[model samples]
Target: MLKRVIQQFQLDVLATSEVEDSHSSTVYKCTLSNGENVYLKIPFTKLKYQRELEAYEILKGKVSIPEMINYWSGDEECPGAFLLSELKGKPLTSAAKPTTAFQVGVLHAKMHSTQPPSEQVLNGMKNEFPNWSHFIDQQFYSFAEDAKYILDERLYQKAIEKFERMKQQLPLSDGPSFIHMDFRPANIIVDNEQVSGVIDFESVRFGSTEVDFSKLYRDFLSYDSSLYSAYQRGYNSIRPLIDLEKVLPFYRFTDAFNSIGWCKRRGNQEHALFLEENLARLKKWLL
Candidate 1:
């Protein structure tokens, strides 16, 4: 498949190595004959491919994301692929300084403030939900439904009860803004203690900016109080930060529930740890 893509797109002679193969896509780091590096991404499904392409178009100029270099729309038998300019940085890690966390917040704030999609852009979006609240409702219920058989019977019922409570308590969404549904440390890039870029847009959608913070808080910001403070400062610099006390718990619970569902559906051995982690979280919240 890689060779076919290279020949069809006439990518320059290069060396390549697999970078990540998530449920959504497989990515490769390709070193060009001239030593320049780029990313080649092949989404596992047509829907995922289309989502990322649409997101890139919508997010351009407003966010620091990978630049699209080349693309091939796939046919029924083959999934298509695209090339992106290599971002220079490692994925954001716990070791990153508070400065990097601040930049991460700045990135989210900028994304949230992005202009609503133009009518023409909306026409092209196949995945836009009616509103942020609708999207969250769908996500929460969908994950809960999938988790029914996978979770312990008593635990699953308890989770459903908690889900209902959260469903009722969730606040009004802030905007019809661009949101990276998977915004977390691994999707953010850090260079010299500064956030340099964000990647992985296959889950991007038009939703409440508040929904985007759940995963970031679960995986990054919640780990350090000082870092969280810095992040709030940066976000407030651009736009007012959401009242985390009111929203974070609801979103975080849903996020963890979604992780369990994802792991259950994918059924990868590697997902065992994630499954256990979310199970622990759910137990802590519900039991």
Candidate 2:
């Protein structure tokens, strides 16, 4: 079906291979007749496809994100997907140097610096929530409800109590900057030790930079102190990150719980248990 769609589109597909095969979507790298490379994102659900499209539209010019070559919606026989010009370089991996984290930090700050029309477009999504805090509050309760059986009740309750207290002490910021929302090394492509492009913006929206940074810290920085400090140096150089004391901790805890809930949902027992065993490790960040 995908092949037919490509042929019908008059694309001279020189060669094609699966680049990323994930639950949500399967991205194919296509080498066109003209020798130009592009990626096609075919999501499992319509919602993910739509999310990807919206993200590209809202963010194409805001930062060093991929450019949309075409947003294709096929007829009844065919399907819909996005064709994006290939981003330069490879994914940042475990082999990356600490300096790569700093480069990512700099790019993140630059992305956050994007204001106005771009932020408006991104943040304007899902207006059902009053604000960022409201959106997070709703998610937190939802996470607790979903993980109640999977996690220890007392530990979960303690987490809620701590979070509620922190919420009261934390000051909420007005208006959001465009945040990648899923900022991390794997989503970042680096070339010559510099950030070339950022992918996986399906979760992109108008939100706090703190939440974005928290995911990075939770994923890699917690283990590598050098990476953490370098990232801080890179980020702080562009713009001072806000809400570090009260708000950042909330995001850190949220990332852990969210990961656990998602892993359990996917029946990924190994990862879920890994998250559970290391749950206590997130406490330092919580306080």
Candidate 3:
């Protein structure tokens, strides 16, 4: 299908074509006749296509985000939708040193500062689950159920109880902001010690700033306390730190559950270790 699209579009050279990630998408790296490198991302679902397109449109020119060169809808010829863009630099893991947590902290802080046009912001908000609790209870809960065997059910239940209590104690703040809901090391591309590009905006949504921060810290920074401190320092440089005392437990709970889901879905053995480790960590923090 992609080969046919390349021929139809007059693409001269193809560099790479393969399944990119867990999502239902095929990514192709192609070199055009004009010698420009381009990337094509094909999505299996119409909802995914529309969401990704909307995110690309909103994020274009705002930061080092990919520029959409063209978009093709599903038709008799192509059963799925595809979007083409200039191929960005290599993934951070490939070309550069792992970004320091402080660097990610600064990047996220800057991202949160970004405000989209009023209508776009409103539309994004409408698409997101109303609150963090609902998102966790619905999305995270269902995912957790699949990996229940790997988790310590007693600890998990306690964490859930703690999460509910913390949710009630959440402090008031300025409402929602545009969030890269899945911001993590894997989704970023770095070159020359700087973030060259951000990819996979599928989880992009309007949500609490902390929710985005939780994803980054849990996935990466939590591995190193030094990194966590560095991230906090970088983030505090942009915006004042919120009183996270109330929400920390809930965030940790969400992180453990979400990681379990990822591991189970991917058939990852290390995920079991991660669950046990995070469960212990959460217990210590909560106690």
Candidate 3 global CA lDDT score: 0.63
Candidate 2 local lDDT, 1-287, one digit each (tens): 66865765568889998875244567788899899998877766555566677767766666677888777765564346777887788887656677888878788887787653524453324432247678778777876776666667777777788768777766766336667677776788888777787887666566666567776766667777788778878888888867565566777777777666666666666465656644655444444
Clashing residue pairs for model 2:
none
Rank the candidate models, highest TM-score first: 1, 2, 3
TM-score of each: 0.94, 0.81, 0.75
Off by over 4 Å in 1: 123-129
Clashes of 2: 0
Query: In model 2, what is the error at residue 216, expressed in angstroms?
Result: 0.9
Query: Which residue ranges in model 3 land beyond 4 Å of their true spot?
Result: 4-10, 19-24, 33-35, 76-88, 93-103, 120-130, 149-156, 223-230, 233-238, 241-246, 262-287
TM-score of 3: 0.75
Query: Largest TM-score belongs to which candidate?
Result: 1
Report lDDT per candidate: 0.80, 0.69, 0.63
lDDT of 3 by residue, 59-167 (tens): 6766567777667766665644454665345554422333455566666777676654576543322334355557656766776676575657786676567766766
- Comparing 2 with 3 on lDDT, the higher-scoring candidate is 2
TM-score (C-alpha, index-matched) for candidate 1? 0.94
Expressed as tens digits, the lDDT of each residue in 1-287 for candidate 1 is: 88877776787856999886355788888888888898888988777888888878888898999999888998776678998997888888777678877888899899888755666454324434455566666777787777886788998888778878877876666776777788888888888887888898777777677778887888788889988998998899899887888889888888888888888788837789889999899889987
